[model samples]
Target: TSQHFDTCLGCLACVTTCPSGVQYDKLISATRHQVTRNQERTFSDNVIRTLIFNLFPYPHRLRPLLVPLFIYQKLGLPKLVRKTGLLKKVFPRLAAMESILPKVTVDSFRDNLPEVIPAQGEKRYRVGVILGCVQRLLFSPVNEATVRVLTANGCEVVIPKSQGCCAALPEHQGQAEQAKALARQMIDSFENTGVDFVIINAAGCGHTLKEYGHILADDPDYREKAEKFAANVKDVQEFLASAGITAKLNPLIEGDLTIVYQDACHLLHGQKISLQPRQLLQQIPGVKLKEPVDAALCCGSAGVYNMLQPEIADELGVQKVENLLNTGAELIASSNPGCSLQIKKHLELQGKTVTLMHPIELLDYSIRGVKLLRK
Candidate 1:
């Protein structure tokens, strides 16, 4: 009230805060009296606000700028930046942010890893896996594990090299045009092959790929293509669960390994796939599936949130760890790559030696009948 006594711009940031607009009776006259007093508007403030909004959310249109970033990480120039003091100025924010964000791998899954198809003397359903840009890099092993389980179940896997970015990075950011163009690229490559399904290892990408119909809803050509293409989009676990085949479990886990699951928001909320993964886990011998409280709340590592907004992500991650702590379980398994890592890191800080795993990893264990825990 004292600040408004002299003059104001009537910004009324309170309008967004008001539940019923009851502020009208007391503040409007005071605000109007000040609006007449201060007519000079600042130009620099507008420029700063516009620039902040333009940079972060418009990623699809801005992906070109990230090429150099990926290149630097690939070349391992972060060391050069640190040694030369260039990091302080060049990427001050990113340098701070990188504490949580894993550096780009020297070998992206696409370049170094070879995808394996099962040697199951019987070839059954043919499917292709869509490895999104980031997942194609960091979580290659998880994708590889996905293929192992698929092929073990008599699937002839065909991972088309052309099945590139799912455009999900931009789709969620409201950069629809950029996402559509990339989506068209992915649809053309997979549709041409006439595969039975396009399995997605990451739940987030699967959800986005499944929603290509909505992304291209207005496009005359793309709408039809996306609809047909989306019919094939399946998260690996969803495909496995819905395949109507008897799931196999080896005699590996003789004793109960209590696992508290952190459900990925994209898997549960985005794809409405809350129960399938849990049901699959129940099939394992002596495996106890423990549900953490409020499993629906996000672990805060939604796609790029953990990387771009570390503070908020950290808050959420810590909260999730608290929930896991209450369960007193040693294993925290999830499907999404970022969530596995973020939850793993936060839980580790609390001196609780919890193992964060991909649900696909557990399926891999049940198939292989060998424990792969890090000693």
Candidate 2:
């Protein structure tokens, strides 16, 4: 634990205020003891302390690991696991994480795709839409909204034929080598396509792809190539806003709908985008925009943390959902897919009708004649 505990403690002053079982001062003393060679590093100490989880854990078994995860959600195992308490022994923090457990939705974004859309038309700009693995498999509707809005705004959409994981999943899990390989492949595939920009619906992948230059800075052939590719990656929301696509004047629903906007970690922290979506959404005729109390904090659905570090993720997700209640927004708006599911589930568990949706869907609704979102 000392391997990273010291650095973690240094970064997070909250460790000093931690009232958890692991006394903060004791952890600090343990770190000192380990550094003084008084204790041998155990396997957990080595793996947990050092942030190299993705590298070895995923290893050559990425697809298998990810597939089971997808299938588990599909089978509603997360909810069952929460209900059964079977994992409480193995994972003592299971109950602490239950509130934030983003249960499986009725339809994952993947099942709703067009699988194949028409080719590039004679539009002013033709861009390659990077439908990331997570976005494609879980948050597919975001992509649909993105495509609908983009196509309606006079741009051609092309899902790269040779795209795979952008290396975000592996990179986050500490599999640097695998992630780098995927990033290189992504660059090669997109460069050959001759598109104006790479549109990304998921903020996480957008941030990761934007790091292609840094991730490949050591490679000779890929350094400049990666740099060039990373420069073109655009978050779907930012891209639309930059293009001056005004939300269409449509007759919105007559009933009441209060919406709160959650600034996803990547969209705010990584991309540093603040005004685009907010300003765009404000253009809507009859929509009340609500802001969270803790305006700047991670929702804990940071990548696969909801499944891996369930407790901590759940704690953060529920706290986020509670913060949303302060604004009384009936719906949660997020740019990231992971945050959407995480917030959506917490709200559902509370017996509240607060739903998770993308800002683009709202923007699309305003732009299009009718609400594209299905009930």
Candidate 3:
């Protein structure tokens, strides 16, 4: 049972496909939590899981390592390691971790966004933004883009400085106690924000944020609060589409810009949001959206699945990239940080050079009239 559950991608694709409308995601989630409590693991498995749970959920903990990581990448050590294949031969898990490291920029070390940003025009809605752990640290630009896009749409954006991880990573991995603790912290962070909607740019974190009700159902004090919080949570794209985008958008590039939107499973299946993102993208001037062959397929970056199960993740990543490439689209619009990183790694592995951006990032460029640099 443990082995079988380990192989499941937890992408919730099955939940979307089931004709009977079975809630397999909930079932699997409950089962995984039970397994975590009952099952014993090998020492090595414990070590890796311990390392991941400790580091990935906390931004302050992850910040210290970035300087060294920046140095490592600046020295082109990753290229040398990949060329030698020493890391893969000796420690495949660590190799998996290294393979997804993005080109760290000076921007990665900065968190310059203010706690509150006013709307560009008359404010239509005030929304709180939840910056996921990896989303804020590694893909900080995406959060910035989200804020810009939201404010441009006549929405005041509030980022609770107290916010941390939404427990998406641990929740998916069946770390029940830790997930609950983090969920409580997330709810507390947004309690006093007084926003109309809590916006999340990352798909996985959005899904988890919306599930806080279920995650805290047993906690008598938080049950009602959790449900209220979950009710207000919205993916940034979802909110913009429903509330309507009022901002003027310019062409992102000179010519017709073709893009294929990669569906992060959490947004596509978990939240039933396949259309909202594309709708927002198409509204941009001179943008053309293309459909991939397997548009609903997972990119193997289901949270930390790529890091934990590298072999299966590599195969899925390769297949996903191939499908996206087959569309003949010039750029890929990825809404989740994990998907962006996993897709990036496989693109490098296959020696392909297609550009990838978060949907919000593209929207930001359009709103600000900044031309996209296309290769």
Per-model tally of clashing residue pairs: 0, 9, 0
Ranked by TM-score from best down, the candidates are: 3, 2, 1
RMSD (Cα, Å) for all candidates, in order, is 9.8, 7.4, 0.9
Per-residue lDDT for 261-351 in model 3, tens only? 9999999999999899999999999999999998888999898888889999999999999999999999999999899999998888888
Query: Which candidate should be chosen as best, given TM-score against the real structure?
Result: 3
For residues 57-121, write the lDDT of model 1, one tens digit per residue.
33343345456767877788766765575654555435434444444443441354344354355
Better of 1 and 3 by lDDT: 3
10 residues in a row with least lDDT, candidate 2: 5-14
- Per-residue lDDT, model 2, residue 108, is 44
Q: RMSD in Å for candidate 3, one decimal?
A: 0.9
lDDT of 1 at 300: 74
Cand. 2 TM to true fold? 0.76
* Alpha carbon lDDT of each predicted model: 0.67, 0.66, 0.91
TM for every model, in the order presented, reads 0.74, 0.76, 0.98
Q: Which regions of candidate 2 fall more than 4 Å away from where they truly are?
A: 1-80, 91-122, 246-251, 371-375
